[model samples]
Target chain A: MSDEKRYLKLHLIVLALVVIAELIGTKSYKLGPGTIVLLPMLYALLLGLLTGPKFLKIIDKEDMNAAEGLITVSVMLLMAKYGTNIGPTLPLIIKSGPALILQEFGNLGTVLLGMPFALLLGLRREAIGATFSIAREPNLAIISDMYGLDSPEGRGVMGVYVAGTVFGSIFFGLFAGFAATALPLHPYALAMASGVGSASMMSAAVGALVEIFPNMAEEITALGAASNLATGADGVYMSIFMALPMCEWLYRKLIRDRAEEVIKG
Target chain B: MKLSLKDPVVITVIVAILTLVGNFVGYKIDPITAFPGMLILFLIVIVGMWITKIMPGNLPAVVYVSLLGIILTMPWFPLGEKVAELTSQVNFLALTTPILGYAGISLGKDLDSFKKNGLRIVVVAIFVFVGTYLGSAVIAHTVLKLTGQI
Candidate 1:
């Protein structure tokens, strides 16, 4: 009947189709592929397309909230199962963690890179505000509400976080690669090498290594297999654990109430 | 609709059962394959939201889809042989959120604006980066050194 209603129906139809596909695929072929398409990257693109530049503006008008129960529960479940692996995974985590943390700092570096430019652009308020504000990540939409990135200053802080996350990956990945070569360690270096490359990059590296050293391919794959799985899950965990919460806490203290007032006025 | 954890839990249980059966009935079909298959199923469920237009855009669709996707795919329950298989396969690198987060953040449309404010953002990100890294490093090297782990 109404335009909005019609659009809603279309979205519903697409959802139904996806469900049906999953059911049939599982029952019949027992396989699932290309599911990576559902990553937050896709969502960010979608939000950008639908909401445009004002997207952050709209998100800012909302109250800071997060799925406190769900996130905490999910992470708890994950920790319970994966926590023990701490012994085996710890060394790797530490080696990678430093790089990861550096990447986070490197991200902050990117934010600073933008700071003076913001002032120069005469969008100082937005610049200053954006600097500390946690910019929205489309995937973060799920838990972002719980954290206070919804506030102006929060958004400003988020802007920094968002920037950091982006550069952090490349820096970390690159760092990992370099360290792997420079260091004498095996697993740690290999993992770092793998880290610098995205999934695809790792895949290529593995393929090339296997090709060049055919005898060692299986060994390399065996060593890498576990990390591959962890790579898939860890990113999600850190986002939920470290990134989103940090954004929320900062926003709540500095900008939450003020944002609501601004919105009301 | 009111949110409840019941559905996810139930789904997880059902998957556990299926994994067991599959391991028993079809010896060739490993949990790993089935794991991805489960992710595919989860993704499909979200497609319904998209079809109905209730799904706002790609991002929401992706988030809901992946959350459910990983749940379905991750081998929480293991059949006899697959039990050890899943355990050995689990590692830190398998946790894929950071790279995915990076990809998402890098897609920000406000890069130009962000670039303009470059100094502040970079400084903060660096400070945070150093803080987190150094803190963790100290804990690992100093705290865990005696354990011979780090």
Candidate 2:
């Protein structure tokens, strides 16, 4: 009856609708594991787009923010669940240290492999900061502090950060699922691959693995969670001490030729 | 009657209820078992959030919750096995459905920003994924081969 209550009711209704849409989308399709991994996300995005700015007209801003804030709870629950799953496998995870280390290398590889293309695309120097860093929530803070948020490098990183936040999970989920099923690699390796720091991406990646290898889901989830935790803890230092400088060097090398071309023209 | 959804207390209560309902419906576990499992999860998250808030460095809530979960459910800890058994029925994958759904909606809000970044951003993201996947894969492959895991 009260305004607050009314707004809350409307928000719940909208959320129910979104969830129903996702359910229908997922249930109606008989897509492969990769597509199924992404179906809910795709449906949510499509519903959000279709509903668009108009939904804003109905839902109050504060209430909308509140709804978004609830996402943290979901993430926390998912992490807790993941952590519980990892408990029994603690010994195994410790023994798999080499694989975990390799996963970190792979995480660093994103910057190594992404920067050249970023530079070739004429992203400018600042983007190197963004491209080189893993671009998760923590790295964003480190980058912002080291090179003020307004700096081009800051903006570049922010762009990728946003892109990663938005698409990272979807991409990782689809890729991990596809890789686990199609590649010759071990599922555990793919599981380690899932822990690229961002929780959503990790969840999506691990979820895809579950769909593909149901029997190995528990081990896979546990390994992925461990790898992700390691990335989060060690990744901060790696980004600051190693990735930033490495990316900068690669960016200059890649961009210098383009700069010379511009001068000659 | 005048409870604001923005209130943390309100949100917490709502989340606890939703998580319970979600576990029940999705996992199809009996209420007695499900309630305790959900309660443990809820407490873990709350404590994890508190720890993150008080911790010196910028520890993410995910890390805290995960660490807490691991510790509480460790084989050495009292009630570890029991909690693990109950929590395992919580249906983590079911929980992921709504989380990913919310992530999608959140992504939708950023479509314009993404569009502004151009196709280049997509290329960079792809490379980010490739670098991560390949970097991990190459190392993992070597390690597994050496250890005879494959």
Candidate 3:
């Protein structure tokens, strides 16, 4: 197919998916301790996946290729929209600047929590790539550039990047909403937390928050957008300077400790 | 992505048109009315992308784009306030459906590789995401409360 025809086909599918998804609209379910909020974004995502070459095979691989570059573009536009949300709330962001800076240190929790579990699960060197950071596109780039993609580190990073793209946003969406309902924290706090830098994940997370707290949509979105931009800005350097090394040190320690225990035995 | 200068503009126009349909269907706004707001966002993003392309450092284009958007719409900017009012017609969430729809469509290329990576990595990855999210939330909550922002 011609370039025009191919893009046209892919877009038509999206247009249809958007229409159907919006029609179904946002739905919330009460299940035990939390609310599971379903969003049009979810439907659009899953249906778009199903229509891909792997499943129903409705579109071409080239069409999928077209979709790839556009992810960054769409996210740019969305973040630009987020930028608008931030201006009016600039004072609040400045006041909460300390919280924003401190919360990013919370990112270290990935290595802290993930590395030990990965050791227990027998992940080895791959754990360094997998657990060091959130392992989104930029993090994946860092891993590949540092340790060539053929390395174990490469496989570890790729594994998570692939898996993350598939399920990250959907998980964020559901989990954020559930946390908002289940926890005692303000929706604004949860909103600030929702910005993980990765566009789909942050937006879906914010979407869920807005769904549950309709009246606070502006504040929730503004906070989420600011937090997300901060995460993205800090994420690249922090992962390189901090996360990767921490993962490496922890991995070596845990492995050596295990070897020591074996020697004692 | 290989691009001539016009790519952002072309893509923006296309996405804006698509967003118009979704905005009308989902939000009950007329497509005619929403198009102008969508165009405003498209202009900001295009300018942002241009800034990123020429800027010396490696900051993600999103930040620059966002900064520009923020500047152009700030209340004190006078003209920015009008930009904000026009753009507000297109809900920010309206932008997600198209991008995510694109994300989903592109995912097929990676699905098999994901499967090959085995279930172990997927499980650990889930932990990676969960840990970052939960930890960040707890800290943000504590700090917000301490700071009395909430």
Residue-level lDDT of model 3, residues A1-265, one tens digit each, is 7877777777788889888878887776654323455667667878888997768989878888877666655566676677676666555556557878788878888898888987787778878988888776556445644664435775677677666766677778878888888988788778878888776688888988898999999989988888887776567668877888888888989999999999999
Order of models, best DockQ first:
3, 2, 1
True interface contacts reproduced, per candidate: 0.04, 0.52, 0.65
Candidate 3 chain A, run of 10 with poorest lDDT: A28-37
B-chain TM-score, candidate 2: 0.71
TM-score of 3: 0.67
lDDT, candidate 2, B13-116, per-residue tens: 55555555445554555557677777788788789888988998774566677779888887778988998998877765445545433433443344465566
TM-score of each: 0.37, 0.63, 0.67
lDDT of each: 0.36, 0.65, 0.76
Per-prediction DockQ = 0.08, 0.37, 0.42
A1-265 in candidate 1: lDDT tens per residue?
4433432332232233222222322211111211111332333223432322344432211110211112211222122223223224334444543433333322232233444444444433344344322232322333332333333333354555555444543433343344334544343224323422134334433444444446656755643333443443354444445544544454443455556877999
- i-RMSD per candidate, Å: 11.4, 5.2, 5.2
Among all candidates shown, the one with the greatest DockQ: 3
iRMS of candidate 2, Å: 5.2
Q: What share of the true interface contacts does candidate 2 keep?
A: 0.52
- Runs with alpha carbons beyond 4 Å of true place in candidate 1: A1-141, A144-169, A177-228, A231-265, B1-144
Model 1 Cα displacement at B60 (Å)? Answer: 13
Best by lDDT: 3
